[model samples]
Target: MTDDYIYHVDGDLVPASEATVSVDDRGFRYGDAAFETLRAYGGTILAWDAHLERLERTCEALSLEHGLSAADLRGRIDETLAANDLADAYVRLSITRGVQPGKLTPQPDVEPTVVIYVKPLPRGGLEGDPVWDGPATVETVATRRVPDASIPAAAKTHNYLNGILARVELAADSDEALLCDLEGRIAEGATSNLCFVRDDVIHTPTTDGPVLPGITRDIVLELAREAGMPVREGRYEPADVLEADEAFLTNRTWELRPIATLDGRAIGGGPVTDRLAGLYDDRVENLCYE
Candidate 1:
């Protein structure tokens, strides 16, 4: 379907181009908003309930009104996908603090703006490309991920200039960039969560670490557990990642992608990574189309 298809704003389906908010909207001027990205496959949204819960959590963190219930939001997403005539697509759910007067304080009387947009999934390379047979090279950027004490990096908020800058550096030097905290401990990739398999155990940075709690990350962890693999969430140093048996990045768009190298060091797909990928594919197929 074309981009001109209707999107759901608040509770109504409206033209995509017409879905606009005021310049004084808190989300626009002050980055006061929360969002969630989900994948739609075969007319079903993957892990919808989880995504919505995270969104609600983000709103709660920001003290913004959600303006809708989880069930209502899911219904709107379903309707938006149908209106766009896309069974396989990407869903963006955004909740802004709404329009307020010229000040930093939020207007309690104003209702939050809730918008849902459907976009076609990215091309072959950005997602799980068939060429993704090995570990991807990762470079550590100069920019550090925001610590949770300052902004709670786990919240999926609109404040992402730090991530954007790191991604730019990665694009110029490496396939991906590994972020660290102010203290220089490994956090995660710019846009995706980091998962590495070492000695048959899967390790990822904890939510307490400076990284977003990615939905794909959770899914991978669940799949790993179901496969009877041990999963650990804790602090990981760059050296630990470089010496891992296998490594991959996970997110909504890309799902799971193998990383072949980090800073020119050689890393490739191992048995554990391959098994995890296979299990992920099976789970998605069953959950989305069953």
Candidate 2:
């Protein structure tokens, strides 16, 4: 039997394959949308409030209205899980400026499109004890992130061409692509936040740059500090990152992934990264939904 999953689009809950939005959808036509990626542990969503809050802020930044209430969206997420019989899953929630005609400008009465998809997290680790598949190799691509002055990085817009291009240019052996900001400083990974270990200190690029302030990034910083690891945030050059003793990337999914190589040059193993990963796991198990 085929295991069919359910998805929610606008106010309709239907089979995943059948869910569709209009071709005129601004998200489809001009990438006018905001989104959030969240994971549910067991039946509870981790950082639901934070994700929802960001979603709201992003929509606001784009002048798109979030017509649904937070409680309403939460209930819909619960329903999606139940319909699909999923206790642990990855969910992508997107809100778009609804169908606009063949025009560049949105109308005054444009409705919003809400879409959420729930899928099994195939590579996701267990609830309490998550495991990584060893260190990953990341390469710096020529594509640079759009500076904050050009487009607000804080808005998780549907415009991911920059990230897509970086991934396209990634080396065949690389697991991810490291992107630079307009200033040639280390910005972040195509899809994750960048962090490095040097002299027993944890360093990450300041969000004052074009980096997206990720929820997991924030949690990792707090966990690192509590574990007595000195955490520093600033603008970092490629040489600094390449010469670092060790480095890792973080995002809502993937959580913590240590970097084995930068442009195929070996970066040594990090005991501090190991310690922080363990602490992050503890925090996920006990403090995730709390």
Candidate 3:
């Protein structure tokens, strides 16, 4: 609740307290919205192109013809961040289907609602501390991921009930809930992507499954390969993760947080995890903190 911050709403900068979307908006009434969670480093939005690409993909998935280009959206984010004097921040950009008639079907003509908001965070790099207190405590939940057939796995939409329900099943002290697909194969966390190491090799769920092809996840894979570490992507069971030499979660915010335990069993934070984390930090330092 960044009450002191400024927010961009439909191209206008407004005080956070005044930022609002109408009740008639499809995004508010039916969750017809696409959003991106972005990380800003030294006032520069990290992977701006990649995040925009994914956001555009989500809008396409929702058929939400937001009449804004990447530059238009980026300007809004830049303006909001500047308005709040934010450099390192947790930023969010959303495009939703604007107010429409109360009907099940959507109309071809669209006037989308655009928004940008930010919350400051500690600097990220070799010289800065991590946002997390320590490695994450994770638990494998019974709530399975929604199949791609129902809702395309790649779409980062506002309809987060699936993730919310998964979180509802997490232990009170747990930091994350790991979700598996319908076939009982490991998928990903409610908000992050899961990665595990075994015998010096890294493995993650294939995007062909019910996994959200994460931007950070792809970047980590790139870093691992550049660091000469083995990487593989495929379906695996809970046993595979639990028995791994190490495990971790990745997202724009967390970056890379090693898993402390899975299902109350100790399982992560080894040499491999440390090395990959350092490599990730090095990239951030070179790209943003330099």
Candidate 4:
């Protein structure tokens, strides 16, 4: 997040400190933007197709004009990696609804604001370190996820006030904030997808509700299925998660993290978390880029 790093603004590489957007930008005035977070493994972006496809769908749904092709964006990311000498890095791609001064609604043909950059991953991450060897603690927040009726939950838009408010309720030592739907059903973590293990089966809330269909979450589900583990996707209540044998969170950053406790209740370690972690590592190591 330093100003020394190189960044891309509308396909042109520039210094991070120099990257700026107009105040009139809708994305700045209002959270009218969509973004995607990706990571490079040995200079390759994993699940490129899935991430790009989701990004495209979000842009289309939000009526944001993204004129660049996936291949073009891929090439640009590669260039950024090379320019910054980053083999393994955290990449954030954001596209705003663009500048429409004194207007709440964006112009029909306005060009979108594009910002892409790479940042150093956390310690023990992407450096062949064991980031999720042990369990972590999480807390339930009072804030509920914005219902799908208001805005598509699957879209990675910049309207993160809900998640931010949830984070405020988390304790200083908590790893994440587990948010529930308005009906008091478990939805997802603040920024990560939630998954639980019960009866040797992996259970996650269906994306039909207010949960982001995370790329990493899908990959984890597929890994579970291919490993012959039973998988279940449906609407789950908080009791279902609290009573589960084990639980974990998934995102582009940590990949997979085991939840040790929720709301002061201890969820013990299990073989399923270990198995899925191993499979995740194997997949990352053997990932092929197009």
RMSD of each: 3.0, 2.0, 1.2, 2.4
Residues 183-251 of candidate 3: C-alpha lDDT, one tens digit per residue:
999999999999999999999999999999999999999999998899999999999999999999999
- Across 1-290, the per-residue lDDT of candidate 4 in tens digits comes to 35489988888999887888898888889988988999887788888999999998898889888687787888888888788888778898888888877777677886888888998653322236654546778998899999999988878888899999999998998889999999999999998999999989899999989999999999999999998999999999888988999998999888888888999999865799889878888788777322
lDDT of each: 0.82, 0.84, 0.91, 0.85
Q: Which portions of model 2 show Cα errors greater than 4 Å?
A: 1-3, 122-132, 288-290
**lDDT (Cα, tens digit) per residue for candidate 1, span 1-290:** 55597889878999988887788888899999999988887777888889878888888888887567777778888899889888878888888988888798777775788889988753231233343344467887899998788997768998888888888887564677889998888898888899888888899988887789899899889988887899999998889988998888998877788888887777766888888777777777777766
- Model 4: residue 24 alpha-carbon error in angstroms: 1.5
Ten residues in sequence with the least summed lDDT for candidate 4: 122-131
Q: RMSD in angstroms, candidate 4?
A: 2.4
Clashing pairs in 1: 135-259, 135-260, 136-259, 136-260, 137-261
**What residue runs in model 4 are displaced by over 4 Å at the alpha carbon?**
1-3, 122-127, 131-134, 288-290
Identify the candidate with maximal lDDT.
Answer: 3
> Higher-TM-score candidate among 2 and 3?
3
**Winner of 1 and 3 under lDDT:** 3
Instruction: Single out the weakest 10-residue window by summed lDDT for candidate 3.
Output: 1-10
Give me the displacement of residue 165 in model 4, in angstroms.
0.5
Which is the leading candidate under TM-score?
3
